[model samples]
Target: MDATPSAHAAALWVGLHLILLLVLSVLVVRQRRKHQVVLGDADIPELTQAVRAFGNATEYVPAGLVAVAVLAVAGAQPIVVHAVGLVLFAGRVAHAIGLSRSGGSSILRSAGATATWVAYILGAVALLFYAIP
Candidate 1:
């Protein structure tokens, strides 16, 4: 089976990722504006730390998504694929927001992180099942 995505679906996926990246960039820029710090400035430790957390989230979210897309293209149930993608997207957005906020904590961040991991695991399990049968 061809793994190439339909034009509309591919556009939607690309747009979704672009939106995520753009939102992160906007958050960084807004914080910099509010604090008047260059990207390398060490004075704004909290902002710097928040940016680092965002980076960490970015790393995991996309990797999980790649697994999702691969499994989806490999014939995981379409409904499952959509549900997983939606959950992962929601988690990434929520995690990013909580991390950027001053009151963020392990609990708040963990909610989204856990959701993302579940999505990844679901995709992996589906892939494994497909491979075995």
Candidate 2:
């Protein structure tokens, strides 16, 4: 474990994102608790769909970051990795905020989704270039 600020920041980035995921989980649970959507009820459709969509959004952040941390550990360019990580973190937070609302332009959500996918691709490229050789 290298004793560098970037290394610590990378870990922090992961940890904070995990916290966001948990927060989203809580939100879903709270909604369920309040609405008490019973099994197979007609009115449950929207709530269930929202839950699924939230889950779909939540699914990307962690899976996208696994290779990133490995690349960071393998000594890939810390600045690029850190920048991507921080950007992804910020993007996810903004995305969750916007999605929780009933209506808004989807620019934030699109930006966040794009950031997540781009970070994953960039991390994969970094791993291939740095970790393979």
Which regions of candidate 1 are displaced past 4 Å?
1-14, 103-107
Clashes of each: 0, 0
* Model 2 regions lying over 4 Å from their true place: 1-6, 38-50, 103-105
- Model 1 scores a TM of 0.76
RMSD of each: 3.2, 3.1
Residue-level lDDT for 110 in candidate 2: 71
lDDT of 2: 0.68
lDDT of each: 0.66, 0.68
Please report how far candidate 1 places residue 17 from its true position, in Å: 3.4
Best by lDDT: 2
| Local accuracy of candidate 2 as per-residue lDDT tens digits, 1-133 | 4466656757877888788787777767766777875433236544554564467556878665776577667776677668768777777776666566533457766776677767777777777888566
